[model samples]
Each structure stands twice: as C-alpha cells, then as structure tokens.
Target chain A: MVDVKSVANPLFLREEELRQAIEMLFFAYRDFTGGPDEMLAEIGLGRAHHRVIYFVGRNPGITVSELLKILRITKQSLSRVLSHLVEEEFIIQTPGERDRRQRLLTLTQKGVELERRLTADQRERIADAFRKAGADAVQGFKLVLHGIIDAPDRERFDVSGGPTHAPVARVGNKIAGDKMPGTKIAGIKR
Target chain B: MVDVKSVANPLFLREEELRQAIEMLFFAYRDFTGGPDEMLAEIGLGRAHHRVIYFVGRNPGITVSELLKILRITKQSLSRVLSHLVEEEFIIQTPGERDRRQRLLTLTQKGVELERRLTADQRERIADAFRKAGADAVQGFKLVLHGIIDAPDRERFDVSGGPTHAPVARVGNKIAGDKMPGTKIAGIKR
Candidate 1:
C-alpha cells in the first residue's frame, strides 16, 4: 500500500514557491487587463463595462438570465453595468419573442467595434504566451486550468461549451490526441 | 517578413475560444480559493486576513512598509486587517533593530497553525493540477503566467524568488528537468 500521509503534507509546498505563484497571479492578471483597460478608460468605461459588452457581442440575442448564469453575478450587479452599456448605445435589449419577461441582448455596431478592440488585445497576449510556451506546454496549461475549475462550473463549462458550440468531438479529439496544430491553435488569420 | 495587418485582425480569435478562456479564469479562481475560503469562513476570517498572515509568516520579522509593498494596499486598508490579526494574537510586532519607525512582524503560534491549514489546501490544489497536467504543461502554465505579468512586477517576481530562496538555478532545473515528484496536478485524495 502507498503511504498517503507523506503525500498530503502542506510542507510539500515550499514557502517561496507559493509566494512566487501568488505574485505571478497578481502580475499576470494586471497585465492581462491592461490593454483593454486603457481602451475602456479613453471612453470613461471600466472593466465591468467591457465584460458586459464582450459577452453580449459573443452571444448575440442571449437572454439576461443566461448572461447572469455565465457571469455568475447577481441580477442587481449585472443590471448596473447593463444599464450603463445600454445608455451608451453599446448594447440593445429587446423583449424575448417567447418570453416577454426575459430580455434578449446584443451588441450594437459600435459595441461590436469596441468588443473587437478589447478582445483583440487579450487574444494577442494569449497567442504570444502560447507561441513562447510551445504546443505541448499549451495543452498541459489548458488541462490544468480545466481541472482547477469548480466541479459544478466544470459541468456547466462542458455543457454550455461557450459561444461557438463547436462539437465536443472536435475539442475532445484535439485534446486527447494532442493533434492541435500550432498554426490552428494560434487562431485563424484575420 | 510577417504580415502585421493579418496579425492585427480581431477575427483571429473566435468568439467561442475567448468565451472559454473567460469562463476558465472565473471558474479556476473560484475553485482555487474555495478550500481556503471555507477554512477561513469557519474561523470568522476571510481571504484578506489569510493573506496578511501568510506574508508575515513567510517573511518573519518583515517591516510594515515591506508588507505594504507586497500587498499593494493603502496603509489604512492594511491597518484594518493587521489590527485584527494583532488583537487576536495571531501575529506579533516588534520595533525594528535598525529603524525605530519600522515595525517588524512575525506570526504567532496560532497564526502559524492557521497559516498551515490555509496553505495546505491551496498547495494540494496546485500540486494536483500540476500532476494531472504533467511537468510539461506545468512549465507552460508558469511560463505563460510569467509572460502575462507586467515588466516591473515580473522583475520583482524574479528578484524575490519566493519564500524558499531556493537558488534560481535549482528552481529552474527542477521545473525544466521534471524533477518534481509525488505531486498531483489536481484532484483531492478524499
């Protein structure tokens, strides 16, 4: 039988190592938001605004309830941000055809332009890191992140599969077989 | 020469991929803190308190000023958390040997015990993810995180090198050569 006590000790995580990870989280998150933050700042917007715009842009005609689920924020919190975006003409809300109580949201043309600018910066950063880390490492990185997700959220992630709804077959085959081409993963050319 | 315009196009990142990444960040961070958050909640403490204790424990006899630098919060903000920790006897403060104005801080026994409990949960989470992802993915994940950090903080990360003070050579070698052993990348034993 394997000895489990030795395996579970907290000391296993060296102090310096954990601290390094903490600092990395701080710096990386800051830099990740920096580009889009600047663009938003120019128009007196903030991170919250960017999130609402980005989600609406990604899921055109998505309901407010669905967005709240994806964002995991209370309706009240989301309402403040959504109100601002709508007032700014960055998003449009219409009564749901099937359920009037539900509001369907989509980005306006202006919203689309802004969303493109914000996400483009983020994509470039991820792309640069992917290229630098190489193909194998990218797979491991993504897998680790997937594993770190909460169990319930993981279920949601698997089910919803986000905006594209690319067949799970494609994602699974690519991940399991490690057949994700470097160029393809780098994303399609503009 | 590469085509710069092609790289600049916003369509390079599909809406699906971006949403997936955004979801991953939200879910991963929530799970990453879940274990510790539970422990803290039971003790009537929160993440902010845990952070103060962890840093003080890591750098025994560190000054308030240094702690502020690591935390990146205002004196008033740190004061609230620090006062509570001190009042509860989780931490002890002493006048600096060199500077009368400096207050050097260290964790008390209670603080150490609590710190251990919180960190154990976090370390196990990270270790599991590392093991599951394997050494290659772990390297990629760390590299990408490092790349995401802003330049100055990145320098701070390089300079501090975590609490272990493990020589950069040793740390780099361990990560690069697949020497980390008996660690899981994710999944709790229970």
Candidate 2:
C-alpha cells in the first residue's frame, strides 16, 4: 500500500510516520469511547453527557465555568447538556458557598452509579491495553498524550500531586477522600 | 486529590495509574482534534463529516461497505452524512466495476482540498507531540495505541509494508503511487 520509492526520502518518511500517528490516534480514541458510547446510547445520552458525568464525578464541586474551560464547548451547548442531566436527576447544582451566584455541579446517586458503570467499561479497555503493552509502553503512552494536550491543560495531569487551583468546596457533607473506588482526580498523583 | 495511604497499596497504585491514563486520553483527544474541529465548524461541518472526507481521501474508490466497516456507523447515520457531502459536490460516488450494485466513493477536487487542510491541522499536532516525546516515546505510543484498538482493526496499522486486503479500484487517472504528499494508506509502512 506504500510507495517504496518515497520511503527512501527522509522527509517523506517523517511525514508517513506522522500520518500513521494521526490515524492510530483516531482509531484508538474511537475504540476507547466505543463501550461508553453504546451504554450512553441505551440511556438516550451521548458522549457529551458521559463527559459531564465523568468530570462531575471526578470533581464533586466543579463549577460550570470550570467545566466550560475543560470541555471547550460553547455556553449554550453545555447548558443544553447540563439541563438534560439535571432534569433527569443525574446531576444536581448548588450555589457555591463563597459566591452565591456561582453554581457548582455534583453527581447524584444515580449519576454516580452511571458514571461508575461507564468508567468501568473504559477502565477495562485501558487496563487490557496497558497489560499488553507493558510498563514501558504505558509510560510512553502517557508522556506522548501529555505532550499532545494543550500546555495549560497539561498542568492538570502533572505528577506532583499538588492542587493546581483553589479547592472547590466539597458538597453534601461528603467526608474527605470519600471518592469512588479506583478513581483518581485530575493532577492528583499517587 | 489522591489519598497518600492508598498509594502504598500496589492494587490501588495500579488503579490510579489506569485512571490517569484514561483522563490523559480524554484530554489528549480533545486537544488533538481541537484545530480540525474549529476549521470544520467554520464551514458548517462536524467531525463526522471530516471523518468521511478523510477516509475517502485516503482510500479513493473505497466502497460504501468498506467505509461503513471502517467508521462503524449505522447505515442510516452514514446515509445522512454521505448525502450532505454528495450534494455539496465534495464527494462523488460511482458504481463498482466488479459489482455494479456496490457504490465506490471518492473525493472530488474540493473534497481532496478540504481533506488535506483538515489533515494538515491534525498533522501539525501529532508532529509536535512526536518531536517533543522523542523517537522512543513515539514508538511506545504507537505500541500502546495498537494494543487498544480492536483485534480486527489492528491489521490496519501492521507497519509491515504489505497490503492486508485486496486492492480496490483506483478512480480517475490517478496513477499508481501518485498520491498526495505526506499522506499514507492504512497499514502501509516503509
């Protein structure tokens, strides 16, 4: 399928390598999300909903603005998705203690269960890949992916285990460190 | 934030590692597609349209069934997107030579141009990541991603410089080995 003559050119080889990388990323992401997509479809939710559930479950008191920055979607788009989740009781919004006008989002019990199930499907996929690729490959995967992320957001995955921003208030009197089993908050290193 | 006590447990550490991999993938994919998505949005197209344009550009004269298999989208959904591209003259479809009933899809000149533009955006992202992550990390990245893909699709990125399937008919006067620069067909390697 490749033109053998072109392979002799160093520049062309680099281009080919990059092209393969692009396709590999596409296929990897597609299959990575496939399991969750099917589950979301069954519930009449889509990828957007899963993202909200995933992030809110990760950050119990994440504000709408914070989510907007993470998702990079327009305010109107997030509003539609957020309203659907709220109307279905998968998520609840509370006014922030520090700023009464700001709404912080948290997952309801239903939301938590759904997020767990969805994430479990994804976790299985990644675990299998990690197991097959071995530790070295897994490390490379993370490093390359970190490089691909925008610089500002790359701070979210730093291994320092330090808080990158002011701590959002934990809602519902949840005890500290009472997160779901097998979960890690963004940028929270072990 | 992670619980320091939990980090001492090997099982918990593995879980944490997997969770971090999952989050990194989500953010990486979001930022990776960011540029192409913006360009497509400006032209009233979404990622779905871009995928169709991309695969078609890569495999000219690719049959609809082949495309359906690659994209894994429902026939109805593909029909909607395909119709839009056909109407816009971005893509053209012709009956297969061996099987007249089968529709073989190829890009029009406009589609080719658009595919190149969108791919260039993605190419820039991957090239930067590869350069930053270095050759060893890039190899590791591909290995891990290859593991993540489904077993059947893994054949698409074999990197053996061999064709995995029968060749589809080449449309137009596009000479054999005459392809867009910096592009590669699936599974082709140096």
Candidate 3:
C-alpha cells in the first residue's frame, strides 16, 4: 500500500492540477445526477424535489428548520416545492413528539417508493465505481470528499467510519440542542 | 503509493457504503458550489450562469450548440441565460470563422474577472484538500471520480494524465469530428 503520509506531491497544488480537479468535479457531478434528473423530469419534479425526498427518507421525522439547515436554502425557496410534495401525498408532516409546534417531515409509502427508484440507479453507479477502484481508493475518495466539506458541517457527517454510525442522529442532536433542547427530532426510528 | 491493485475490500460495495458515498457527494457538491452560488446570487444570477461563464472561460470561442451539448440543457433553457449574459456584455457571441452559421462564445474582460473571482475560493479549497490528501489519495480520488462518470463521456475527459494534456481540446476534436469535420471549434488561441 502506498503510504499516504509519505507521498506528498506538491505538484498537485499547481494551477493546472487545480483546474483539472474543478472540471472533474463538474463532469462527475453532472453525470452522477444525470439519471435522477431524467427520472425527476418525467414527473415535473426538479432536483429540489429529489433532494427533499432523499433527505427526508434518510432522516425520518426531521424538522423543517433542521432540513432548511441541511439544504442551506431559504425557507421561502423550500416552501413551494415542499407544499407540492405534501399535496401530492409523497410526504407527510407530523408535529414533533416533544414540540408540537415543530413539524417533522417523513416520506409516505409513495415517497419511499419514489426515493428508492430515484436512488437505485445512483446507488448502483456508485457501487460499481467503488468496486472497481478498490478499498484504498474508496478511502481516498471519502477523505477528499470529506475535506471538501466545510469544517463545521464535517462533524455532522461521518465520512471516516463504518455504516453503524448515524450521521443524521448527530445532526438531530445538534439542531435539537440549538432549537428544541432535550427534544428528539431526528430520533424517530425507521 | 498504495498499490491500488492489492487492496480490494468487498465491503465497500455494501448498501450502507453506497448510501454514504451518495451523501458525501451531495454534501461535498453543495459546499463546493456554495461560495460561487452566493456570489452569483448577488449578481442576479444562479448556478446556470456560473456554469456558462466557467465553460466559456475554459474553452474560449466554444460554439453555442457545443456548449448546449456540454450543459445538457435545451435551447429554450439556455436562451434566457445566454441573452442576459450577452446583453450584460459578460459574454460575447461571434459567428464561427469557418462556419458563419455557428456562434462562438467567449467571455469579456468582465466575465473573465468574475470567473476568476468565483473559482478562486473553490480552487483554493480543492488545492488544500489535494495537498492534504497526498499523491496516492489524489490519484485514487481522480480514479474514483473518473469512474463515476458515464462511459460514453469518459473518453472526452482525460483524467489520468498530467498538466500538459487538455481535456477541452479533446472535447473540441470529438465534437468537430461528428459535426464540423476538418473544422476547429476549440482551436481558438486564447
């Protein structure tokens, strides 16, 4: 195995290398989302809708403010897309157990199905890549991606460990501490 | 360097691992674009505008149809953004030297400055991560990202090499081959 600590290529910081990195990200992300984009377009739902479904499916019973924080979009921007999803019966909102005023969002059965279908192609694509790249590459991929995230949000995501750790639970605890202390917003069991 | 061939962990293909990869991409892309998105918002633009500026800046004198193909957006979708950019003088469109019917897009001084400022933060972020990740990890990162791209478009990108190779040039050659044979759309000297 190549010692990650021993092989530090200063050339990687060159402008050309940096620009290459930029373009790679541009193309990779474009292709990564391509399948879901086509699928969502058929239903007249854009990326915003897909994101809402994906996050809510990931973190069942997540509150509106917590989601807004996760998405980093304004409440006004999320309102219309959210209303549409709820009206379409793809998502259902329930008041938080501790804080009745806090609406916790979860996917309906239909939402779960749509989320599964939308994510299936993506999951397979990622799996194929990881499988081909091997364990070391996967580790490198995760480290680089985690580094790309802002530090404050990095802790909220566990990019370093196994699957048993729950990132959403941490996000819930953080959000709950700030907004609804002692309340279990992200603690809703799947 | 990690002998990428030696360490093949099968567990990386598990569903949870796949999901983590998905979330990492989601969060990473979001943060990667965050700085530019804010700057674009201030100028009454969005990610679409930033993308147009970026690609046009990268491949000066790139053709309209060629750009549309790269963006995977329709004529109708690009029309408004293109018009606004042209009207605002951030970008200029001139007829191709060989094919007068084809409009070649290039950024103005203002556009170049904007693109520079917009990408500075992102470039720095990437460079920092790459420097920290070391050569092996960077190699692995590139391989995984390249693998994430679809097969058809994969050849169009040269992710395996050093700074001397130009990916946009390859894209130009490919596009020129299919449509404008023996004509150079991407050969404009910057």
Candidate with the greatest TM-score versus the true structure: 2
Tens digit of lDDT per residue, candidate 2, span B32-85?
888998999999999999999988887888878778888998989999999999
- Per-residue lDDT over A76-149 for candidate 3, one digit per residue giving the tens place of the 0 to 100 score: 99998999999999999998887899888999999999999999989989878887887777877877887898
For model 2 chain A, the run of ten residues with the poorest summed lDDT: A160-169
- Give the candidate number with the greatest lDDT: 2
| 10 residues in a row with least lDDT, candidate 3 chain A | A167-176
Give a tens-digit lDDT track for model 3, residues B1-190: 3322213443432655677778888888999999999999999999999989988987788888888877889999999899999999999999978779988889999999999999998998997888777666776787788799887555454454332323222222222133435323222211
Cα lDDT tens digits, model 2, A1-190, are 5454453465776766777788888898999999999999999999999999988888788888788887888989999999999999999999988789878899999999999999999889888987887666676777789889988777667432222144332233322352423333464533
Ranking by TM-score: 2, 3, 1
Model 3 root mean square deviation, Cα atoms = 8.1
Tens digit of per-residue lDDT, candidate 1, span A1-190: 3323323554543444445555465456657877998989999999888878876776678788777866777999999989999998999999977779977898999999998888889877776766776555555556677666765555433322222223222232221221222212112221
| Candidate 2 displacement at residue A39 in angstroms | 2.1
Candidate 2 chain B least-lDDT 10 residues: B161-170
**Which is the better candidate, 1 or 3, if ranked by TM-score?**
3
- In order of appearance, the predictions have TM-scores of 0.71, 0.80, 0.78
Angstrom error of the Cα, residue B109, model 3: value is 2.5
- lDDT (CA) per prediction: 0.65, 0.78, 0.75
TM-score (chain A only) of candidate 2: 0.81
